[model samples]
Target: MIKKITTDDLRKMQNKEGLILQGCGGDLQEWQDGINELLANENILLDGSKFENCLSFECNGITCLLFPFEENVKLDTGKLAIWRLRSHSTFGGTWLSDYVPNRLGGYLAEQQKPDCPLIGQDGNIFNLMGIASKTLRRNGMADQATEMCERITQTAGSYYEALNIIGEYVNITSAEDADIDEDQGMVM
Candidate 1:
């Protein structure tokens, strides 16, 4: 079943998580406006301003933003048989400090990559790399954090692949033990 999230529920997730709005039933603009109104009714403002049907929100130190998404359904028939496939994909939501990377892009682009990380040949840190690096720094693993930054800046791959690799070194058992292994390095 689809679980409906309430404003109170969102408040509970403040600072701990952000919402990823998707699959609203409408055209693009209408969908965006729907989410904007839903959040506005909950007292969440777009960057603490009046509602302009924008995609990013800030309230009580919590941040929420919409990521780019695609939904595809396919049907194939061969040899008197038919096959159907349905898939949903979404990308580009990384928690960075008090906000997401590209709020403006959240309004304009199909893929919201405001400050998205560089991948493959670009060799720059973006998205999950930023999040993991931030997590490492907050945990007092400055050296490890530095190493993570360096590693991500030098690595090459898709966002999902890079996130999985970096995530290997970022296990958190508790507040006291973020469990970042120094010797393991940033690459898996």
Candidate 2:
């Protein structure tokens, strides 16, 4: 079974530092419950309909997007894996441009190559992927990303240096700022 992000972890993130992550793929209801509980104690940005239906809280303080759905999740080792454990899920993305921040993906834009993984997939791939993300194999079949990453680093040059950002996450368990601005709650 996948190790769902712990409630205590969520609480620690929001109250102490206002950092939370969303990986919107699997049972949204489960994630929904987690956020609703958090919502009862904090100010969150969520799509009313989607939040009510899937219960995703695109919290204001979220700064990372976890990506374990790639061909080899283990490729996310080292610096990147840490970010995955803490980043927001691309599930909340409204458009391609907004999905992956330029830093992580800027190299793709420059290369102008379609890096998509082996397509021709069948059913319920994303669902299985979510399960995998919760507790994926430490090492999967994909080649180590180190070499590719190094190549990217060399290529990104000045742009990568400029775009990289150290993000923040919150795990609030207190109700001190538990009021979701009635206005920001609009399902955007």
Off by over 4 Å in 2: 1-26, 43-50, 53-99, 102-188
Please write out the lDDT profile of model 2 over residues 1-188, one tens digit for every residue.
Answer: 22333222232232121222344545645655555444433333223311332212333444322212222222212333343344435423332233333222321211111122112223243332322222122223122223233333464455333122100111112122222332456211
Residue-level lDDT tens digits of model 1 in 1-188:
13333222333333442334333433445545654454445444333333232244433444444322212211111310211011123322233222223332222122211221223223443655666666666655555567656656676466556665565557523221222333346321
lDDT of 1: 0.39
Candidate lDDT values, in order: 0.39, 0.29
Worst 10 residues of 2 by lDDT: 165-174
Looking at candidate 1, the ten consecutive residues that score lowest on lDDT are 79-88
TM-score of model number 1: 0.24
